[model samples]
Target: MRDAHYEWRCKAITPIWTGDAYQKNGRMIPSGLLGSVRWWFEVLVRGMGGPACDPTDPDSRCPDKHGNRCVVCELFGCTGWARRLQFKIVDSNGQPVQAAIVKDQEFVFHFTPLRPILDEEWALLDLTLRLIADYGAIGGRTVFKPSDERRRENMPQHKDYGLIEITSWPDIKVEERQLRSYLKQSHWRNMDHGDYAWASLDNFWCANGKHLARQNKDDSNFNRVLGRDERKTCKICGDIHDPPNKCPKNNRYPHRHSENLINKNRTNQWIAGDKQESKKVFSFRHPQRTFGFVNPEVIDFSEMKKRLRKAWPDLKDDEFHQGSDLLNDLIRSPGGAP
Candidate 1:
């Protein structure tokens, strides 16, 4: 392990939820934070056209036939290989954090390299952290939303958990060409991933300058984007599929609702028939930003744009960013405003 390490100081804009197995929220869990970091890192790797495997799956996991692991597993670890970095959470005074769930509290992520960390990998991590601070949320309970009835009747107090602001981080830069070369060097980088609909930047989209209006009785923007409880009329039968039943006219199941399409389960019978996580990520608590990855084969760019427009009409064209454009901008200006 290297003697030197990297640290990122962050302030929780809202409550942060790195909870225990019972979902208790008193203490900070390093593994919870690490899992979120690894997830965003995998997304960025796929955005850069690199190979990243589903670590949770047994069939498609790392350490394949030739003992080779995907780029993510190489850094995050697998069954046989250990992670390249040791991670922990600390306070502003550099002491390990015990209790958590405090709002406006500053915390530091301490990352000590277990081996010689690559320049590209470091850059990717930097970008991932910045991306989370700017547009995404970390930890658990990110998908929590109050019921419509609660919104209308009670207006209960809710905290936007996982919203954080990056207060400080090390300056790191690596050329796009070097990153591409590193990805190209991986033997599995170009392998066919048609089966697994993993989140990739190639099919990613992000929008800013919009907030989820919880008080809106007609329809919440979160539900609009997530398609929660929203049913669509079956094209075949001209009947609204409330419970997502089969179409009587055609004897075929209706298309999946937005919720099902966005929050796909690994075992759900779908086109890919492989492990696929949620395609959409909405910073519900932090309403100014929303983003999601789409399977281009399922929902094209035009369709996604239309959906965003419908959900948040105020989203200007300039506020929207595709995966490739965002990646390029990050590479060009590593330290500039995101």
Candidate 2:
């Protein structure tokens, strides 16, 4: 019987073979598509025999969050490998800009130690590596910009710093322009912008309307804007948008509202409205809330760190710090993390 530790370790590290059957010691272990069907058959056979698996208990021996034990997802959820991609960008003083950078300049660059192949094995191997950094936005947007307070204090501005597209890997197939636009539009949900994440996802789904924008070059902006008529009001903020456009301050795409744009007073009011309100609106519109899955399984940091230490048995604390700083610099662009 496999113990919890054994099962966990196997699930964590092994890339379950998505291939055909292989005979090992004259015992045929089905794999790939056939294996999937066979596993289902065996489960049915087991359930019929007497000892039944509980369908309600998620933490039970079920392989999936749905308690259906999806072997494929159990082996590989939406989880991705964390890799340390180093960028050696030097300032005029020859000092490295050591900080985590994200989506730098809208391009993607593929990096591997000694040029590692981007095969199934490398991907699974990379997942076991510890992530030195993660990226997100400030004021509830993915795009980062220094706040007024930070700017007043003369703090560094944070922005995306990864390449827009990784040209080397054709398999990755990133659309630089599309991603940049998606990210930029996604920023509108930020407090500094207008907190438009809720609807922004529709505009930027699958990296921004891939079907329409990418293929048809559709220029029709899909964001909801208050026309001359629309019955709606902000419940939490108590700001109303009753025609003559009551809540122009909270409008997602206020610039599109030409009537509201005409008045300097309205502009100043929105410009000066509680910054917290802006944050609320941003949070309300955040793409992550709409798109993020519930109870997502995270890469176990404890195991990952343990693996890292084991792999580099002689690595110093400063080396780890330096690696972290380098990774950060690679992700955070000049504007800084938002």
Candidate 3:
């Protein structure tokens, strides 16, 4: 680890509930932990263009081509490729850690590189370590908001973020460290992060979004991402709405300019005498997250855009940025370090 020709070893300690449950040797194994961490890593150096695979799909293997595997397979592994790094889940005593049940348990693991960790790889590892520390979850069903949450039951949603312990990491700089920390554990996953919607039930960001522009008879007033808040806007009205203002349209949908962060009672339908039922709706609703559900759910970016329109419409936008645009800027910005 400290030398170039010898292998390097690092340790990770879980601070909250994790969903990595690869059952092997009578213990819950976490074979994909490295791979998961590598994803966030790839997003950092390579920008957004990576493999188009489902990512979480077990069958999602890198295509055999000249660079289809990208940074992931090069650091990890794939068919006809040997993993540059290897890891084993173990206990605090440094023995292989085991879990009889998936939830309510904790484990530790050691990451060892087959060779000296490259500077780029170290950059990835360093960024990931700091992220998990602040965001608060790992493996699956990880990431707790409010930063101080002690359990997954207290978290509003399970995300790609988590809290892990590693002591030997080198110093790095990130100006958006606080924001990235929030993003790693953010509820943005409840919104659409891609083009296709996952389970519609998990789309809670739509609950607070009651803007009638999308359902208004004037087809020109649909929502668009604009402004500092990166919130929604009425393309027809050309005016920013906020603080839960009501739209003048009689489309049965009430436009609440301000987004509701924790209201589970908000509905996607406006009950103005059942007139908006067939409203070509794409709004999300807030329902209680099913307790003890560990598997991650995927949501599309359209729903996310809706939520952004309601919360912060004036945020900046670039030509290409997945999920949140400011997030893309954060990665490229120089002041994000703690």
Candidate 2: C-alpha lDDT: 0.23
The sequence of per-residue lDDT tens digits that candidate 2 reaches over residues 1-338 is 11111000110110112222341112112222222322222222221121112222344333333433322222222124222222232223444323222222222221223323323222222211111011111111221221222222122222211112212211222232432333234212122111221211111111111100001111111111111112123443435343355445565432223223123343222322333533111101111111110111221223223323442355344332222243234224321221
Return the lDDT, model 2, position 329: 42
Sorted by TM-score (best first), the order is 1, 3, 2
| lDDT for position 279 in model 2 | 15
lDDT (C-alpha) at residue 172 in model 1: 71
- Per-candidate Cα lDDT values, in order, are 0.69, 0.23, 0.36
Query: What's the CA error at residue 298 for candidate 3, in Å?
Result: 14
Q: Pairs clashing in candidate 1?
A: none
Q: How close is candidate 1 to the true structure, as a TM-score?
A: 0.79
TM-score head-to-head 1 vs 3, winner: 1
- Is 1 or 2 the stronger prediction by lDDT? 1
Which ranges of candidate 1 are over 4 A from the true structure? 1-3, 146-158, 186-190, 213-218, 228-281, 285-287, 334-338
* lDDT preference between candidates 1 and 3, better one: 1
* TM-score for each predicted model, relative to the true structure: 0.79, 0.20, 0.41
